[model samples]
Target: MTMSSLTFLDRERSVAGPGYSRWLVPPAALAIHLCIGQVYALSVFKTPLVARFGTSETAIAIVFSIAIVMLGLSAAFGGKWMERNGPRKAMFVSAVCFSSGLLIGSVGIATGQLWLLYLGYGFVGGIGLGIGYISPVSTLIKW
Candidate 1:
């Protein structure tokens, strides 16, 4: 969890040599979008979550909505921090947050705590999605 570990993600390093392919940038950006954009598919889990938690569909839907809302808020608010620090850091942190949210959400599921599920997946994961979704745009623009 040091900055040095994230050097490979640096914009300059991505094209550090003449052999680097500018053509690859779009695909890389696409991959990022495809990955983070899977949030839309989360609705597929609604029925399963309801059965597992014995909760109403509305509650689960609220969790999904909260995550989306937090995504917007974090992206808007975190843009400046990303610009100041760098996309590499932002992306790495987002990965951590995203993964951490999943892990935390699992704990909630195991313990049957709805609040923990919302805090973990909705709030934390949403922040990760926001930061991750926007992380590569600046780097792509720079290229």
Candidate 2:
């Protein structure tokens, strides 16, 4: 075949069959995850919590640390589940858990309840982070 024909065939193969649109999925996925990654921005709420609850910085920092540790643990344990369930479902669940944690944490701060912060931001939100992190990793590897 001519050089031109070879190039055309390559292009055809790249776009054909079970193959995806090379130009689309990556950026679309990145846009979504960028928004979701805001969970890691939890520190933004720390000052407000301290202001409302009059809690010590050490206490607040401990709360954040618990959340991070839980996140890591959940991801480690749930990575297989994420891969089996698919990224979209995993991401949706993660969003719900993460948001719920923040809301609960807000209530805890308003009421001066430290336990609520642990429940909301540490356990719930941590689970969300774990699931969200694993959800995309496998998908990208497969892709």
Candidate 3:
């Protein structure tokens, strides 16, 4: 074969076969998970909410509890969705929902609307956490 033809063949083989270094994928996934877990650190937002809205600590705590409960529910029920849709797609969707929740919560805080906090952080972000939590579990298990 010509030099160009040989190069083309090599490229095709790399693309068609197991092209990734399996060792690298796990560490990369770990890094991503660690970063994403910071979502749980959302307690950091509580002080600002309290300062701005003058809401009680118990009320703010309830919001966090609701989000956690929803996260658990979504993970349990959405596992099948994750399985059918594939982890990458599920993760993408989860990230969008999660980010959107933060944005909505910010808007709610700015507007002084407590309900928006519930809708945004508790509901939307909870769903993201749920989906994200499960997205990788089955994938890793299969691997």
Predictions in order: lDDT: 0.84, 0.73, 0.76
Q: What 10-residue stretch in candidate 2 is worst by lDDT?
A: 7-16
Residue pairs in collision within model 3: none
lDDT of 2 by residue, 29-87 (tens): 67756855765676787787678668877777777788878778988988876656556
Kindly report the root-mean-square deviation of model 3 from the true structure over all alpha carbons. 7.0
Question: Which candidate has the highest TM-score of all?
Answer: 1
Supply the TM-score for candidate 2.
0.73
Tens digit of lDDT per residue, candidate 1, span 11-101? 4444347687788878888898898887788799889889888999999888889889989998999999888777777888899988888
TM-score of each: 0.86, 0.73, 0.81
Q: Between the candidate structures 2 and 3, which one is better when assessed by TM-score?
A: 3
lDDT for model 1 comes to 0.84
Candidate 2 has an lDDT of 0.73
Clashes of 2: 0
Q: Sort every candidate by TM-score, greatest first.
A: 1, 3, 2
Q: After superposition, how far is residue 103 of candidate 3 from its true place, in Å?
A: 0.9
Query: Cα deviation of 11 in candidate 1 (Å)?
Result: 7.1
* Candidate 3 lDDT (Cα, 0 to 1): 0.76
